[model samples]
Target: MENVKAVKPELEFTDYTNFEAEPIHPVEGLSQRIIAQIPGSSVATRILQFEPGTNTSPNGIQIHDFWEELYIIEGSIIDLELNEEFKAGAVACRPPGMKHGPWKSPDGCKIFEVRYYSKGQ
Candidate 1:
């Protein structure tokens, strides 16, 4: 794989807050800011935001072909399948083919996430 993201100088804390978030298609109240990405691949770093009262049940259970790492930046979200609430500071790593989610956030939430494939896809 080639370097897909452009190099940049160190960014200030406030710089991250300036990225515009775009709505995730067909999912109401859910949005993301893609900070870095590998073109034509499932490799990227992003910030996912869920507004208050947001529910992702419409997406159903998710199973991906790539690894997913997530860190909750603020607020909380409930995993509908697990019936568990994960709050800020929580982290999770899901390997390829893991089934998870359809989540809901009652008070809003933000998460920093990275998605990538292993050596052999």
Candidate 2:
């Protein structure tokens, strides 16, 4: 498929407790809820919430098999790779296999993220 085919689902806040929070592997202090996805594709989208003082990269930073993009919807987080803090309205994009993160959120935060692999990857 060249593009997403399913009609977009209504965007709304689902109960936080309704979704299981899965740890972002190779990282600590962050969890995510997959909100929408398309079948038979690498595409996956989620909301990631961070716990206060959460930090990743105790061992090292992380990379992914897919392109990754994120928008900070609430609060602030520190990007260890950039050594900078990002707050609400901040956006970031990373190509597949790019080294990034080892994040830290001092006061907790929530971010919306989309991840996907290009066709024939």
Candidate 3:
């Protein structure tokens, strides 16, 4: 099915304060505000937030079937597997089946993400 259609009128800037953040299950200190999504599918646009001292070890290494594009909107996070820290302004594009994450944030982080299945999927 096609992605969800935009329901709001065009705006010069979006006020994120109007959106409510919902907790990401099975993982504490992580939450998301979904801006748009295609029901019954993994296709979505969202803002992910990681609270300070949060670690995603419980989730373990992540490998998914959908493409994931992420932009660090603020703060930073460290990839446990890589021992590398990524700060704001950093961006990443992960194709399906790529392994990543199980991250930790010492100072908290905010990321804008888009996830969708590739045409071949």
Give the better candidate number (2 or 3) by TM-score. 3
Per-residue CA lDDT of candidate 2, range 1-121, in tens? 3365654356686775576789976567778887766665557788898989888767478776788888999999888889999999999898877888777899999998987766765
Candidate 3 segments whose C-alpha is farther than 4 A from its true place: 1-13
Candidate 1 clashing pairs, residues 3+ apart or interchain: none
Runs off by more than 4 Å, candidate 1: 1-14
Number of the top candidate by lDDT? 1
The candidate that achieves the highest TM-score relative to the unseen native structure = 3
How many pairs of residues collide in each model?
0, 0, 0
Candidate 3 lDDT (Cα, 0 to 1): 0.87
- Give the clashing residue pairs of candidate 2, or none: none
Candidate 2 Cα misplacement greater than 4 A, ranges? 1-17, 25-28, 37-42
Candidate 3, residue 20: lDDT: 89
lDDT tens string, model 3, 1-121?
3454544323456777567899987888999988777766778888999999889999999998888999999999999999999999999999988899899999999999998875775
Would you estimate the TM-scores of all the predictions?
Answer: 0.86, 0.73, 0.87
Give Cα-based local distance difference scores for all models.
0.87, 0.79, 0.87
Question: Which whole-number lDDT from 0 to 100 does residue 29 have in model 3?
Answer: 97
